[model samples]
Target: MKNTILIGACLLFAQQLVKAQSSSYKPVEGKIMTEWAAQVTPENVHREYPRPQMTRENWVNLNGLWNYAIRSKGQAVPTSYDGEILVPFAVESALSGVGKTVGKDNELWYNTTFSTPKKSRNDKVILHFGASDWETEVFVNGQSVGKHKGGYDPFDFDITDHLKSGKSQSLQVRVWDPSDEGPQPRGKQVNNPHGIWYTPVTGIWQTVWLETVPEVYISGLRNASDIKSKRILVTPEVAGIVDGQQVKVSAWKDGNMIAEQTVNPAEMAKLTIKDAELWAPGNPVLYDLKVELLDGKKVVDAVGSYAALREISMAADENGIQRMMLNGEFLFQYGPLDQGWFPDGLYTAPSHEALVFDIQKTQDMGFNMIRKHVKVEPATWYHACDKMGMLVWQDMPSGDMGNGWEMKVGVLGNQSDRDRTPESEAIFREEWKEVMDDFYNFPSIVVWVPFNEAWGQFKTKEITEWTMTHDPSRLVNSASGGNFEMEGTKITGDIIDLHNYPDAKMPDPEIFGKDNILVLGEYGGLGLPVDGHVWQQKDNWGYQSFKNQDELYARYAGLIEHLGKLVEAGLSAAIYTQTTDVEVETNGLMTYDRKVIKFDVSKMKSLHSPLYNK
Candidate 1:
């Protein structure tokens, strides 16, 4: 496939006035690359469509370079500028072009200018942000438009009111990320880097841009798929009409329309298919959807999206061991441990291709599943999974500081007083809910994990119950590892998620099968070697590391083959050590730089294929 995205060469000059491209830049302090490190100016940072689940052709890409200034907290906008920082990549990331830092006591500011596409009298312009870390307040033409708190979910403000008859418009944004110094969900970031904790991403870690729409528009659409019933449900967020609004929905397979439906504003509406094509790693079938929110004679707003009919559930095998079943058949899900970090971007990847490239490479190595360990991905990542046929076991990005010995009782790291603090609990719960709400629409996500290895884990019963109630559509894994019994024979879910390191031993599956499903949450931290392709030069760590690619691949094949044998011996799914190397960890099948795929793909697939059948 011909790649290497090409835009107008004129954009190169236009981008220089905005900011430098960080993609071409490099820094010495870290391995993660930032968009600006390569000098990505406003002409291009993340020009790809931010929302892959729902897309529109008229929307514009606002990524590239922007004037950045680092000022004291609550400082007024300075007429003077510090320099250019790439949009989307945080200031801490090398890809930001300007390799600088945004700390706890400072505010990161951005200013830019763009045109309104010379509106045709009735069109309304909307400003979009894929995501920004911590807290952000936005203004356009020097007028405050809106403010958002969460870092993961996409947010936007209608900018039609801020635009004018002029050929161009001015935009401004302010951001403050507290990192690990505050109560917010900062994930695995710390001021100090050692062991697992690395760097923190602050301010505008996602794409930002503007789009023009009609006076009335379909602002959002939630597409939900039922694997058992072969139906897709869509709910639209509309703005044009109030009472008795009409919505037109269409479903397409390949290029042909298969079904159609009409419904009123808000709530569960269906678009059914006769013989639904189930989405699998080998045959990923997606159905196109065109939903329009209308008022009588005119179409107010419209959006295009796609979904696949797929199911993941826990079912008892002939031997009575509960395992993950896909499309009514057992498929022992095998995948890498994904830390979701980047050398240039830290929390963000240098480019959208860098994001999809990770998943694609993992799949190429013959794995169908990924344990998105302790991090959430941009929407485009999930969309890539949908298109590329990868299974996802999504983990809530972990945070809160407490050591191993303290986090016992299996609560999964909630032993400290912070876990007892009601305010902390509320904040964690709210942020978790925001994440669930953000990605709930993606069909590729098969499981929702609330806690891992008990890091900052507390209030297990309440949190697990809330997870189940909030998202009954997918499986819930409580405390992937804990000192105390978390499943407790009471919690309900598709699989009993267990965690162990480099050991093939199973955790007495007989006890877990009574009330809930059974599966190995983690195991097999096997490491391999390749010259000139590592995240760090020394003090590398993995559950086990090897001398060369041949030896590593051979040992890994044996390990996975042993896992396949365990499928009949009562194993459902097992998450391998990792997708790529992170910081000092070298167990990944691929190096952290992502320039190499260290495994033998065909051999790995051959060993894993039999796990589903047995």
Candidate 2:
């Protein structure tokens, strides 16, 4: 009888192994995957808390496999799903388990179920989406909850009222993205991807989760710091607050409490940190923050947060040229142009470790900053930048292209600003503001880029001025490598930028550096594709393709040798072509799959050490 039972169990285990090898729910074939992609499974896809800036304890991660269907636009929710798809991975990506396209003509629908979290009578359940592309509408228990229309920022819906009494509830999400057909801020995504533009990502590409909060909770928080004053501002956006309810904020360092403050919901709570440690690239000191909502003295709701007391401004260098200053000192910034894309997961990384790998690699290469070119990353990306002491230059995703301008750098363009329709203009304005507000708290972000090479640049002066005024904490690069708008004799933004390829070049300091900080927004595009580690076998090209690693490193080192001279000539910052190879652009320091680092890390670090002191 015991042998019979053992035989039956052995047969079951063998059958399961076969099923796993030929699993129907596996990543699609044909694309190069990162090391972390092999670690991904349905049970462990982006399990980390989506929001690290603002976190709560009681939450449920709604990631993993979900029933997905692509139907015609405006069609009702489908009765049957086409197949199982991995949540947070776009349908066009291989990691999604269904590499397909929805396009503008169809709507991607997702259906899932979750058990209700244990909550008290006064507890409110909130549904959160870290991010989704284009237009998204949510339905809970077959009832429409709300709709959101931004692709790059986080949004949430209060689902307490829509909850069912039973332990289980239904969640339905419908998403429609017009890609390049509409005038929305989609960075480098085109229906027919070629050259610089790549694949279209539809539906949810970020984490979706649920958290439980009290009846009156802290809905949002805005953290800002003043290095000169040695204080941090904690502004809490509270919901359902009444009389006698107050908000208390406390700061801690190295496991010890440093400061605390209490204020009303509408007022900003200020905590003064004496002898505060300024956050910089070398010493990125982050103070642990705790915010609580109090009813008189009893705490009603609380959240864990953090802050960095750092300041970004502009000042004059010894050469009488404007220089970008960090904490009142000029630091020549140099880093790669980071295009946050993956071969397996498009915009979404396969895991939290995968998302952090690029940043870590860049630091390993001895770069201090990253130019986030034309795309906004998840909040966790910025948090990683903060914790790792990396400076960030955030760019608003470019869209609504085809605006005409002169094809020249270091000079004013023949044309300036696209005459966008009222609808398109309003869409651009609203989304840019939302992106700024959502990421204003991260101390690593030192620059705000409004337009990139005039892709969809409209109302340049108005947008640049507004961004500078809205966030006085960070300098605004009005148009990076884009058309120039002059206010009499000066440029409209804080920096006068130029773009050159292959060889290192800088904005003519004698012409505009004295008034504006001079920068080479993009320069190096040295490519050397490794065998068995490229997106394709042929047509993989860079601005200057090399035959071997020796040639690439020699050219890259020569470019740095000349860039140091420009730094002495009032050049404040420079950005290389990219952090990793994307599609056929083989100009990355590392390969797209992240399996190979083209240049030696220690050698690259030694090559970049002189830029800081130059």
**Which candidate number would show the highest TM-score if scored against the true structure?**
2
User: How well does candidate 1 match the true structure in TM-score terms?
Assistant: 0.90
Model 2: pairs clashing at backbone N, Cα or C within 3 Å: none
- Per-residue alpha-carbon lDDT of candidate 1 for residues 1-614, written as tens digits (9 for 90 to 100): 12323455557666773344444443445454433345444455677888877787887777766789999999877687898777788887767766666788998889998876655677788888888887899988888898888667678888887876678888889998877777666777776666667777888888886777887677777778777678988887777656766888889987999988888877667877988888887898889998887777667778898877887767777766666778888777778778888776788876777788888878876778888887788898998898888889888876664634333232222332225467667767877898898888777898898877667776666777789899887787876654333446544445556666676544456665555565667777777645566556778777887887887877777776677666667776778887877777777877777776777777666766776667
Where in model 1 is the C-alpha error above 4 Å?
1-42, 117-123, 403-420, 483-488, 492-494, 528-531
Candidate 2: 10-residue stretch with minimal lDDT: 406-415
The count of backbone overlaps in candidate 2 is 0
lDDT of 1 at 474: 79
Best by lDDT: 2
Please provide, for model 2 over 116-158, each residue's C-alpha lDDT reduced to its tens digit, 9 standing for 90 to 100: 8799999999999988998999999999999999799889999
| Candidate lDDT values, in order | 0.74, 0.90
lDDT of 1 at 587: 78
Candidate 1 whole-model C-alpha lDDT, 0 to 1: 0.74
Q: Which stretches of candidate 2 lie over 4 Å from their true place?
A: 1-24, 408-414
TM-score of 2: 0.96
Measured with C-alpha atoms, the lDDT of residue 18 in candidate 2 is 53
